[model samples]
Target chain A: MATPYHLKIVTPERTVFDGPVTYIIVRSTEGEIGILAHHMQIITPLVPHIITVYPEAGNVEQFTIGGGFLEVGNDTTVVLADSAERASEIDVARAQLARQRALETIAQAKPDIDLIRAKRALQRAENRLKLAGHSAGGMTSA
Target chain B: MAAGGLKEVDRRIKSVKNTQQITRAMKMVAAAKLRKAELRAKKARDYFEQIQAVTRRAVSKGGAQKLVAPRTVQRKGFVIITSARGLAGPYNANVLRQAVAKMQEVGGKNAAAFAIGRKGRDYLAHRNIPILQEFLGVGDDPTLHQAQAIAREILQQYLGGEVDEVWLTYTKFINPLTHEVRTLRVLPVEEPPAEESGAERSYVFEPDPETVFNDLLPRYVEVVIFSALLESKASEHGARMTAMDSASKNADELIRQMILMRNRLRQAAITREIAELVSGAEALE
Candidate 1:
């Protein structure tokens, strides 16, 4: 395998992922970005989305992170999540329920109540549910 | 002064020494808490930078009037300041003094006070500095919940148009060794200089920009308060450690002086007895 780059995923709650990874893909406010050994130094804000990590010598790992930022410089990719949970760690059932409730809330919210925020919440929960291999795909990503 | 008056000084010295020891222990505990506080602060910065970047983009796109600027300054506002406890030094006094000067300045009459930390709260109250709210016993160890509560209070006030501005006064921890008293503008949403969030990266929000920012902005405010709390906490510990170290040193010097005084008194007594003895011998001869 090519020399693995340093990858660190951190949240205020915990350090979710830290290791060397050969390949990784991150979804940000910009879009999905693939990182390898020699990516330029980039610092950008993250949106609610999924992250897929292909370990240097193992199967891929997945995660969903809330709004935060990423500082990628040198051979390092640091993800600072407002909140983050590993696909293996997040309870799929709970995430689905959260997705349902948020969607319902969005449907019933007052006019002044923000539709975008409710949608983002739905997306965040659904992102986790789908990544965790839920069969339903949250009624959006079909 | 009589020789026995020295005993009173000795007793006072012992009491001061005990107090210093307790202060020293408290300083250590604060130092440990400061470490975590710093991490939370640093983590919070990343979140702010991201939100700020996005907000700047949205604002710059010519949607200023459409989006609500809750913090746009109008009349009066609240400034929350946090200070330290267990006074062995100017730790609390320095911050409160700075707070006084600031409240008199930019705040004018409109700038109300939300003084956190006991010492700060008392100082403002005593001066009859119109305090909108006060949070005491926040302690050297501050919590995220504390930050949230503070945010909620500020938000309620801002949305209700009760205040048009907001600020915070506390010491900022530059390092474990450096703490500086500061008053940070918390309301009117002083947007820091923006980084180039990609224009190409930007697309319409799923529903709209205003909708996204409205939710994010409040969270952004929460995060900012959280950061301040963290900064103040670290500063408190740094100040405590410094204060305790100096206090302990002063006590050591005091003890040395006390010992020297006792030694001199004992020597004086010895000389007097010797003089009496010599005189008695002479009389016998």
Candidate 2:
């Protein structure tokens, strides 16, 4: 059995998760990376994506995180995100609305609107929707 | 005459009681908001400290040359934060006074302000200080998006060379009853001293050191602004809560005194009526 390590996911508004986890997977700017107990220390920026965590053998948790950074230290791994929400906590309707709005804004291509911000918004909405959909589908992937 | 006096006292008591109700309600509201604000501030502080540590390590490695390098001060920018409304005791006044003092010391004519709240905007405007931008209606709970927007404005000014330096002024929350106005430099990011280990560890940077540092610098600025906003918010609520509490207490005291006076006046009027009746009865006898 792999040793469990302390994992904490924090956002500007609040700390979303703080507990011990046996394994965690997150997508960094470079690529997808997984951390286990006693992983080497490194810091990398994260892209908007879903983070999967295994607290125990059978229990699984997922969260959608906005772009931020992840730091693996000596004893703890920390995910510092601009925003984070549990998969179950994600509001599908809101995400869908946001995605629609972002698409409209990008399609219009108004000079006044920031295209980059709109694109990022779309990415976040999609990420949330994907996570929410994955969880609602079933425990098949886990 | 006694009856008229009694009526006046009664009216005064009613007014004082009304004022007391308002202050009491305001105090309760502020207290509730303060609880939420304090929790947010605590969480933000943790993130802020972590980011600061990471930035320090990055700076110690001599990355992000443009941002870490300090230039000669020519023109300065001040980001002043204050509450939107008044009646929060000296909450707005304390920060504004300190901000103005700093502006004057830094060369008033050369300083421009990025006002965060209406109070700061109006105060600086009255002083004829050049306001580069004004953000109003932050409301009770400020979101990270608002902080990001403000940071973007400051970054634009700094990067465009419009301002040589930038300073942030806000009230720092110490406790529920204590808060102090603080001013700290934001632009030309201060390089924190390296860790005491004295041994350089070759840590892995995902893409490259330069890229990570560059991204980290701007993010650091955003985090600083966000955390400061949280702290200032907590302080504002704390100040308002304390202010309203005392105001309510004063109103209570005033109401008590007025009620006492009304009772005394009523008694005096009754005594006067009784004396006149006795005198009339004695004259009839």
Candidate 3:
């Protein structure tokens, strides 16, 4: 295995994940970016997506994160997300319900209703569903 | 007569017991809330540190205009955070008193108060301080949105030159047994020490570092506000838990004293009856 680097994912409420990981794949604003040990220092904004991590000696862990910033420094990569939760923590039933509600609201498309809010809601639900291992169709893959 | 006195004492005891129960329950609730709030505050420390590191790097690399330069201290903005509800011993009082003192130091007329909780607003209102903004009903659990709203208001005032400096007054949670009310200067961002500046590697800026720094400044402010809110909430819960615990103990003491008095009265009445019975028996003989 390659040299492991410290990977820490923090949200406003708490630290969701922190450990040494050999490989990390995160969805940045540009697209999916992968990191390994000794990655050059870089900073970028992140989008709402799932982050997959391969630890040195354990099963791969995944997290669903909202938009925030990512910084990769010497031997350490930090993800400062507005909100983040482990994939296993996501409730599939709740995500499905939320998605259904958002779809219905979007289909109605009344001028009085907020389309942007509906879209954001749908995005969050889809993200949760995707993180929970459910097949959410027509969304960008991390 | 003894029975009547016993009944009254029992009633009083029952009332005291009820009050003790209520206080005990409140203390338990506050203890649970304090645990959760402390956990949250601890967790948020990591995120706050990470942001601070990145922002510090950006601030160091950026030029003068992008930097948050401190201006002359003229008008000041005080963002005072106190408990929405007051049963928390001196939690609200300590914070409000410090806030008022700080505002006075800045000259009352030059201080524009931004009250985050009901207690602070009531205090400022009573003092007739000019309120820049007031937010109420921020319960024990504060959300990030609330922090963002407060940050936006303070940032606007600072950027618009309404206030040259912005200060935050809140309770800093030290431990369950101790919390101290302190004020922090938030606006005109403070620069990190020189020793901490060596950690940054030659980082690549996507849209340039200045723009990123400018964008990050407001978020830093928001995070600071959020941190203060979390600490204050934890302190509030801790203070309430301590206060309720003491109150319950005092009720227990009162109940014990009342019971002791009732037993003495009953003993006296019984002795009097026995004496009368013996005297009547002797008279019949």
Best by TM-score: 2
lDDT of 3: 0.84
Each model's chain A TM-score = 0.85, 0.84, 0.81
TM-score of 2: 0.86
Where's the lowest-lDDT run of ten residues in candidate 1 chain B?
B59-68
How do the candidates rank by lDDT, highest first? Answer: 2, 3, 1
Question: Global lDDT for candidate 2?
Answer: 0.84
What tens-digit string does per-residue lDDT give for candidate 2 at A30-131? 999999998877778888888999985567888898889887866778888888998788899999888878788888786654777787788788889888
lDDT (CA) per prediction: 0.69, 0.84, 0.84
Candidate 3 per-residue C-alpha lDDT over B161-219 given as tens digits, one digit per residue, 9 for 90 to 100: 88888888988889987999999777766667888667556787655666556656788
Q: How far out, in Å, is residue B250 in model 2?
A: 1.3
Candidate 1: stretches off by over 4 Å:
A1-59, A66-81, A87-142, B1-6, B65-74, B139-141, B191-203
CAPRI tier for the interface of model 2 = medium
The interface root-mean-square deviation of each model, in the order shown, is 7.4, 1.6, 1.4
Interface C-alpha RMSD, model 2: 1.6
Ranking by TM-score: 2, 3, 1
